[model samples]
Target: LVAIPPSLLPCWTIHTSQWSLENTIRRRPLLQLGDNSHRHLNPSTISVTTEREEEPDFADHNTRRSEPIRVDLPKPATRASTEAGGDDFMSSDQPRVVESRPSALTSNPVHEAEDEKDHGTVERPLVGDQVRDVIRLIQCRKCSRPLQEPVTLPCGRSLCKHCLPETHTRENISYPATPNRLQGFDCPYQECGRNHAVGDCGVDVILTKAVDNFKAEMEKARETITTAEVSTHVVIQRPSAGQTGTDMDDETTSRVVKGGPLVAVYTLADSGELDYNSNVTFAEVSSLGDEATAIDNRTFSKVKESVRTEMDCQVCYALFYDPLTTVCGHTFCRSCLHRVLDHSTYCPICRRGLSVSPLLYRESCPSNEHLKTIIQTFWADAVLTRGDALAAEALNRHREFDIPIFVCTLSFPMMPTFLHVFEPRYRLMIRRALEGDRTFGMVLPQRPRTANDTHFVEYGTLLRIVNAEYFADGRSLIETTGISRFRITRHGILDGYLVGKIERVDDISIAEEEDLEANETQQALERYESAATHQSEDSSTSRPAMTTPEDLSKMPTSELLSLGVSFVERMRQQSVPWLAQRMLTIYGECPNDPALFPWWFASILPAKEYEKYKLLETRSVRERLKICCGWILEWESSSWSLSDCRIF
Candidate 1:
């Protein structure tokens, strides 16, 4: 028995497992070396014997020996001959192993050739007889299929052109195309872990041809086996009860016995023909890695659409952004689901009731690993398409209509708000903002007992980011200034951040100083006349006699303006409250002009939000001032305890 070396076990075992019994018989042949007992055997005269093993039990039996069939093997192909194909064919210095069954026998006696000087040298097998399967272990690790258009890397491993890391496209399709040498990708194989530029690799045409030839042989063998199996099966008629025949059968059945690992069984069709394709066996799923698990010819052909669909958000119909799976075994993008739950406490796909509180926490809804692996492996094109689409969508998003929001403290116009963005959602938000408009809204979150009640006040300020400093960990310190006030028309979440459609709110500006002065004069006269009428109605005797409109018309216009101004001054001179004074100190001083003073005071004062809400409701500057002046007077006279104060 010729013992197979342990070093050859991996290759031989893989070959045995891959091919059927018939293929094994057609491929392997028995060979024997000249025995020392033969006295005519000279050291210089090397003798080789070859035999064709046709029986399946050839390896098991060693008692029989055939007559010595002395034959000469052809020389190995020269490097110059292979290079004729192309420069891609680099001649290998390593000794090539080949197998062949000699067709012609040499009858010359060994003693006659003993005197020859070059008699001992045995010729290498011919190139045509070389078995490419010997190098099958070096096939591409990714596809586990033989390498095509092989590119030998700097790491000394050759892989299919498509399997190289440099061949992978950018995640963002909109990104400018760059050379493969600049991509800098690490090798996928763990055994030879190294990083190299794509340009550094060269095509190995010899290796590519070898792999292609091996695949061709495998395909031809499979076709032969399929044809033989189909032809061997013929329908046999059942014998009658009166007839006693060796081939007699009560029920009809068709079976074919073949001397191989797999039996060629066939089913008879109604037309008395064998169904060649029916009941075919398939190879077991190999445990190669993520690529093999998620992608195969069967699965790929089954799902003809891109694999990215499995990782897409049902609502957005895009690749998942922070994916989350529901308890109903349905998966969705986290932000899309959150926005869906905002309207109802049920899952988007299944209508099953889900608690809103837990979904609010990212930890409670982790990404699906299987889907993620599928995307990262077999969906490069899909990922790039989705990323470009998302980037374009973000760029087109309007600041007034659909701006992302930071739901925290309130920010006023012209005020600076510093933020430490650490949350992954917020980081994504900041990154997107920087890429687009670099602007977002800041609104105060409604203080609810539970996190499930995620709400934001209607009024918020738009902040334009100035500069942001990002840390290595993806955290950022952003500096921004409130650009303008906006009231939320509608609210929703994207990815993980809040987004809203807002209308701009600004202090009403006058076109001219003359028009403002005229309006102020008209307002003072009207207020004075109305106040006089109100006093007279309250107490006729105590109050001064009311003047008729005709009489007031007779009075000088200058006198009416003077009286209104005096009344406003008296109210303004009254002792300011502690809360109002603290606000003035912190927010700097209020505006000197009476027309602009009310707006400045309202923004800084520590007043009830409802009161501030009322201030925001009015368009006239005079009306807002009147409300604030009245409140100040009431606080001074009522002697109410300070404990009643509540910061808004």
Candidate 2:
């Protein structure tokens, strides 16, 4: 629990003794003689004096400005109040003055003095004065006295001259492992408020020095820890079972047999499901025995036959395993199709030229309708049994967990492809998300396909759906904010959509430092404001006025990027090569780069998706900065040389 100082209390105020004459004056309004006179004066008379006359000389002559008017009147004989019905007249006019001692409301020096004494010893210093005094007191940690001669330590502490020698000695001699640097020194003063090591001064010099040393030590420690942790977590790959000796293999085989019949049979059987013997060829099963026996044999034979037949390519009437379908509705097993196209194009079925290359079966036995059904059944069963396990693994691996997956717009081999069709389950998922978090993770397939494909970038940001409107055509327009980067940990098929587990990554140090530095840099950038404003003023072309340092600092990073982008464009249009180059150098070529120069340039230029993605994915700020600087330099040199040569 942190204790807030009494001085820090919201309503704490200095005592009366701490108040100065100026403070008293500010708190109480002055009683003005003019105000009193104004309040007592007749309103009509006041208005007549203020009102202007049409003819000043005539008005003045008629008004008779300063004389008092006197009227002759009859005098009445004076009589004593008792003789003239005393009580009623006395009560009606000339009321008697009641003599009373002054109340406490009136100011009195003695009473004020007593109140001041009761209010406690005059605070030694007012609140503002106390703060300054405290600051002086805290100046030098070693001396525990006001810093008469302030000196800075590399650790950023300010120390008095008297304490510097002792601190320096301790800093030099103290072992790196020692936790206490000021063990030998006692408190600098007997009446010190807090005891501290002589070397552990809270002065700016000492503090800064200590901080630098500490940072160096921490860096070394971190490196060691990282090396040790990484070494311990090394992953070793085991050799294939085929590489082991027969004796070892046989032993493993025996263990499998002991484990279970299913394991033993699967271990020995090719394909793990079927077996063949001379006496039981697939072709000889039809001729087997009498009516009942023959019926049973036929049934079994038919099942096997169906399996074998489906294994052949339905389009070619050959072994169908690894079959592929083209966009033109032509189907072929993998090898046959590769041969027919001659590594070229055109569909074999409809004779329509296939614009896309050969497509591989996304699923095993894709051409077999029965096989597809069987596979789906098995897949559903597997999902039912192991979905929780998969989800848990994905979570641990930092992949998207429990969400509908979509395919990439572009396809490549082994890459997950997005289908044009949005299934009901996925629509439900989207609806649920919009009603709730309104955010989702996207993950790219390890291998992308080139044909009608589904692939995404490896790392993606959390997209916040800002607006979503369903159109009459049944499409949605979604506006989103990219929040943070995430990495995919695992992926699996769930009801025909991809499901993944994703983990969020945060780089705090860089982000915070960048923010601070950006603020400072923006202030420094204000020096260019005059140039910008002058250029704007001189030009007939309309442009935004130069932003103030304070305004630029207050703007969001994104808005700043936009401003920089716009400035760069205007400079380019004006043929202000130096300004354009400077802008390009400052903002990197990419969003993730130290600057946005390159990205801004590329935004104006024609760049491929892959090229843009490369820039977006480049995470190193230093590298991005270097790249932008290089581009700026090249552009500058070329433009300068060209301009010089043109003088001829």
Candidate 3:
């Protein structure tokens, strides 16, 4: 071994050491660091000679042109020749053939693997047919199952992946095996409780290959036995002692004629043209005659039991309906898995991430072909059972009304509302709504004394969700427009959400007499206001008279209309200030019709709830108009009084 200089020491590492200090010093020349005389010892001084190939100018159809990816590959190690220098650990001179390869000095097992893979010289166990026996013998000797994706340790024994116990690394030695620190995982085989770095413990690839080959061989052997049984037939004959030549010829001809049809029938059965009972054929009942009847019955019973267990869904604990296997290798009923993924993008049992792309468009996940075939082949009855169960469930859901309610802020007809659905109950409620009618009622909650006593208002606005965007965590942003107002007749909880049996609530129909009276009141008020304005010296151009309670009986319909119309015009002109502009922005220009104008003004005003509630109670348009006019007059008088005080 040659000593490296301090300047070059950082560039080179001591990869391997096999000799004692005394022996190594005697066998190799000693070089001191930072010595100008030993500048040759510097790694920078050594020139590497590599054969470079010129890149092709033209692009190759099969290859992509890109910069060469840099890899930290370990250089192959070389042992000194016997003639040049003796082995430091050897007493006698002997030459041994050494395969030049990278030194196994990497602390990271993953890097060690990459080096071997790039060099293409993987170490494999030297066992032929014995590989099968080796794997079986090394089985999680505790449970006695064949080694599965075996992890071999220094003990030379293998353990199934799951049988290995939790491991800990040097960093945070108290914490058990975690995904991030798995590189330094320790071997947990009972017999070999050794802390083996993950990459150091090579997987049993050779054993895996051996096991696969053994299974293939067994399958081939079974196929061959079945083919032989179907093709081969035995025959026996005994000649009658007192048979005439003509009688024997006729008997032989008749037997030969019947054999043709029998051969054709068997051929048709083999080709699947005949609908023969496969179970009977499998048990060789026909070939073995009546003696095989008992054996066939027992075989059929065992087969039915195995099929029932294998074809059942783990999630529902029932027969699989459209079986699907997730990326995590767990099989589930397709409908069951779809419902799970609607709320989550992970496998229910394993919590492993599952691809949600298919489910997003409501497409079925990839089916597990093996499970599907098994159900079709040995247990078609399970398919029928699953269908029956699904139908019954659907019927039950149908029997119950599926109105989903959203307990949120108040909404009104023709208004747009945006909502963020994060709560689990609301998320589910939205999904059910989208699945069925794409409509849900949005209601405000009423004040309750206790949490459990939460109740919503009787009347709510039904909203039709136009579009919804769902996030990965089951949160959704939905855009909805108010459909119509509905009054809850009966309310109850369903699936963690509020539901109500509701009837649509329409605006009260206005009577013709009420419209005529509203006109009459407007005319009378307009005349009385004109007469009072002529008599008052303080009258302004648009300002009207402040009639007393005594003048109420004499007021005419026209003057009242004048007051209401002037107030509305002032609001639209932005001259009269109001607290809220939300309704002004949303509803645009106030309605001009006498019948609707009063109700529209009442709804948009930022007035007391009791005042607005009173507006809804009045069925007559004239009455509502009267109430609104009084409110406007009161506000006008209050503003004037405040100005008069400020002037004084």
Candidate 2 structure quality by residue, lDDT tens digits, 217-321: 323433433332111111112223444222322322112111111111222221222111100101112121133232222222232223332333333342332
Deviating ranges (above 4 Å) for candidate 3: 1-402, 449-454, 466-479, 512-565, 572-585, 594-603, 609-627, 637-648
Of 2 and 3, the candidate ahead on TM-score is: 3
- Give the Cα lDDT of each candidate: 0.41, 0.32, 0.43
Q: Which window of ten consecutive residues has the lowest lDDT sum in model 2? A: 275-284
What residue runs in model 1 are displaced by over 4 Å at the alpha carbon?
1-401, 447-454, 467-478, 506-586, 593-599, 615-618, 634-640, 645-648
TM-score of predicted structure 1: 0.28
Error of 1 at 582 (Å): 10
Q: Output the lDDT of residue 472, model 1.
A: 85
Return whichever of 2 and 3 wins on lDDT: 3
Q: Candidate 1's residue-wise lDDT over 137-178, tens digit each?
A: 224545544456766554445566787774442221111113
Better of 1 and 2 by TM-score: 1
C-alpha positional error of residue 70 in candidate 3 after TM-score superposition, expressed in Å: 99
**Number of the top lDDT candidate:** 3
